[model samples]
Target chain A: MALTRDGPRSLGEAATGGTLRLAGYLLLGVMLMMFDHRNGWLPRLRGAAAMLVQPAWRLAATPGRLVEDARRQLASAAYLRRENARLRDNLLLANVRIARMQALVRQNRQLKRLLDAVQSLQMQGQLARVMDIDLDPFRRRMVINRGARQGVHVGQPVVDAHGVMGQVTEVLPDTAVVLLVTDPSSALPVVDARSGVRTLAYGAGRGDLLDLPDLPVTADVRVGDELLSSGLGGRFPAGFPVGRITALKPDASGSYLRAVARPLAHLDRSDHVLLLRDLAEPFGPPAPAPAAGPPAALLGPAAAGSAAHPAPALRHGAGA
Target chain B: MMRLDGQRVLFYLSLALAVLLLLLPLPAALRPLRPWWPALVLVYWVLEAPGRVGLATAFLTGLAADLLAGTLLGDQALRLTVVVFLALRFRARLRFFPMTQQALALLLLLANDALLRWLIRVVSGVPLPPPLAWAAPLAGAALWPFVFLLLDALRARLRLREP
Candidate 1:
C-alpha cells in the first residue's frame, strides 16, 4: 500500500498482495469450517456471533411481528369472546382430566409400592415464544426466546399443544436453537398407539411428514395409527403423540415397509412452544407443587405469568 | 479530489441494510427468488472503494452471514472472499463500465459465488441442492441496477466521500 501510494500500481504488483491475502483468508475459513464440523469446537464463538447479530434479526422481524400484533389487537370483541369461551371449555376439560390423572397416579404409586418397583417422576414444561424461523432451505430450525438464562439446557425436549415439535440443540444466553422434527437430521423412537409396534421415525424434510423406514413387511403399523414417543432414548418423554401414519409403501425388495406420517404438532405455524425440563428420574414423582384447584397452579407464579402472557398464536401444552 | 469524511458511516449503513434485507422473511413461494443482498452491497463497495472494503471485510461479513443464516461456519466466508477478490482484481474496468456492462459482470461474479457455495456444500456432505437454488444469482443480478442506484443515491444524500 505504501509503495503504491505514489502512483497506480500494475496488476502484477497488486496481485501479489491480493493473492497472499486471499490465501490467508481462505486458509482461515477452511480451518474454521473444519473445527465447526468436528465436535463443534467454537460454540462460544458462535454464540457471541449470534448475539452480535441478534439485534439485526430482531429489527428485521419487527415489521412482521408488529403486523401480527396489530391484527391481534384489531380482532373484534365477538371473536375475542368466542375464543375466550372456547378456552374456558378447554380449560374445564383439562382440569377434569388432570384430576383423574392425579388419582391414577396415586393408585399407580400404591401399586408400585406393593410390587417393589421404582417410582416415576413427573416432567415439567416451560413456555417459550418462537423468535425466528430458519430460512435456509436445507435445514428446518427455529429460534426460541428461552435459553440458558432461563434454565433451558441443550437436549431438552420441546413440544407444542398438539405434540412433540423438536429438541433444543443449542442454547445461548437468551435463546435456544431447535432442530424441528421435520428436519432431515432428526429422528425419534416412536410406537404405534394401537398395536404397540416400535420403530424409528425420521424427519422427511417436508415440514409435515416423517418416514418410518426399515419396518419389516409384517410390521403392524397401519394408516391412522398414532405414533407416540416410546421413551427409548430417554431424551423425550414417552406417550407424547409424534405423528399419525398417513401412508405406507413396501420396499422394492418387498421385505421392508416404508411408512410416512404427518407430525401431530403444527410444526410450521405454531408461534409458541413448551420446553420440558428436569424430566427427573425415569420413574419418580414430579416435583411437588401446591395442588390448587386448577392445574395452572403447578406452574408457579413465574411460569404461569410467562405462559399466560398472550403471545400471538401461542397455545399452552394440554394439561402437562 | 473526492472528500474522505463521513463515508465510513454510509459504507457501514449500506452493509447493515443488506443484512436486514437478507434476514427479512419472504413468503415461501418467493423465497427461492430472493436476491443475494449482501453480495450486491459488497460488490458495490468493491467497485466504488476497493481500498477500504477488501478481502478482510468480505470475510468478516461472510462470517456474520453464516451465523445469521445458520449455515456451516466458514462456507459463506470463503464464497464472499472469493467474489470480493475477483471483483477487486478487475475493479479498474468494473468501476468504469457502463451500467449494462457492469450488471453483466456482476452477474458472472454472483454466479461464481453461487457455484463456489454449491461446491463447498457438496464437499461438506450436503446433498446437491435443487436446480431452483441456482436462481438466486440471477435474481441478485436483476436487482443489481436498483441496489447500485439506491446506495449511490444514499451515499450522495449523506454526502459520503469516495476513497
Candidate 2:
C-alpha cells in the first residue's frame, strides 16, 4: 500500500492487501460456521446478540397477526356461534378424558407405591405464541414470543394441543427459537403403542414426515400403528403421542425395516404452543433437586415452579 | 472518516432499511422472491460512494445481519466482504455501463453469492434448499432497477460522489 501510494501500480498490486483481508474474513466465517453447527458454541454470546434483534422479530410478526385479528373480528355471527358450540363440546369431551386420566394416574401411583418404584411425574405447561414461521425455508424452525425472562430456556419440550412439536434450541431476552421435530437433524425415540417395540424416529427433512430407521425387518411395527414417545431421548417426556406409522418399507440391505410417520403435531400452522416443565426421567443421572414425593410447598422456587412437570431436573444435565 | 452530513446519515439509514427488509416476514409463497436487500444496497454504495462504503462497513453490517437472521456467525460478514471487494475491483467499468448492463452484472454477482450461501448450508449439515431457492437471485436482479433509482435519488440529492 505504501509503495502503491507513490508509484503507478496494477490493479492486482493495489488489491493485494484487500485480497488477503478477504481471505481472512472467509476463513473466519468457516470457523464460525463450524462452531455454530456444534450446538451453537458460545450460546451466551449468541443469546446476548439475539436480544438486540428481538424487536425486529416482533415487528415481523405484526402484519400477520393484524390480518388474523381483522379476520376474526369480521367473522360472521353464525360462524362464531357454530365454532363456539363445537369448542364447548370438545372441551367437555376433553374434561371427561382428563378426569379418567386422573383416576388412572392415581391407580398407577398406588401400584408404583406398592412395588416400591419411583414416584409419578407432575409436569406443568407454559403457553407462548409463535412469532415467526420457518424463518428459513431450508431448515424447520420458528421463533416464539417467550424467552429467558419467562423462564423459557434451551432444551424445553414444546408441544401443541395435538402432540409433540419440538424443543427450544435457543433463547433470547424476549424470544426463543424452537427446532422442529421435522428438522433433518432432529430425532425422537418412540415405541409402537401396541407392540412395545422401541425405535428411533428421525426427521424426514421435507418438514412433515419422520422416518423410523434401523428397525429389523421382522420388527412388529405395521401401518396404522400408534407411536408414542418412549422417554429414552431424555429431552421429551414419555407417553406423549408422537405420530402414527404411515407406511413400512425394507431398507436396501434387506435386513432392516424403515417406517415413515406423519407427525401428529400441527407443524405447519400451530401458532400457540405449550412448553412442558418436566424434568428428566428417573433413570437419568442423579439430579440436583431433592428426592421425589416432597410437597410443592417444600421445594425451592425453581423446583416448585417446575414441579408440575414430573421430573424436569433429571434431564437438565443431559439436555442443557 | 465520514463527516456528519446528510449523505452520511442517509447512507446508514438506507443500510438499516435494507436490514429491515431482509428480516421482514413474507408469506411462504412470496419468500423465494424476497430480494437480497443488503447486497443491493451495498452494490449501490460501492458504485456511487466508493470512498465511504468499503470492507469495514460491510463487515459490521454483515455481522448484524447474521445475528438478526439467525444464520451462522460471520457468514453474512464474509458475503458482504466479497460483494464489496468485487464491486470495488470493477467499479471503473461498472460505473460506465448502461443501466440494464449494470443490473445484469448485479444479477450474476448476487447469483454467485447465493451459491456461496448454499455451500455454507451444506457444510452445516442442514437440509438442502428447495429448488425455488434459486429464484432469490433472479428476484434480487429484477428489483435492482428500483433500488438503484431510489438510493440514487438520496445520493444525488446530497451530491454524493466518488472521493
- For candidate 1, write residues A1-320 as lDDT tens digits: 22233235456765889999899999999998887888674466767776675666677778768878998999999999999999999999999999999999999899989999763657788999987444465667787888889999999999998999999888887888898887878999898999999989888865347989989998887889999988876788888899999999998888899999999998877888999986634523555643334344455676656553433213233433
For every model in order, what is the number of clashing pairs?
Answer: 8, 13
Maximum-DockQ candidate: 1
Model 2 off-target regions past 4 Å? A1-17, A34-39, A283-320, B1-4, B29-34, B153-163
What is the TM-score of each predicted model, taking all chains together? 0.82, 0.82
Scored by TM against the true chain B, the candidates give 0.90, 0.92
Binned by DockQ into CAPRI classes (incorrect, acceptable, medium, high), candidate 2 is acceptable
Give per-residue lDDT, candidate 2, residue B154: 66
- Model 1 alpha-carbon drift over 4 Å, by segment: A1-16, A48-57, A99-103, A119-121, A133-137, A280-320, B1-4, B96-101, B126-131, B160-163
Query: For each prediction, how big is the interface RMSD?
Result: 4.3, 5.8
DockQ of each: 0.41, 0.36
Measured with C-alpha atoms, the lDDT of residue A230 in candidate 2 is 82
The docking quality of candidate 1, as DockQ, is 0.41
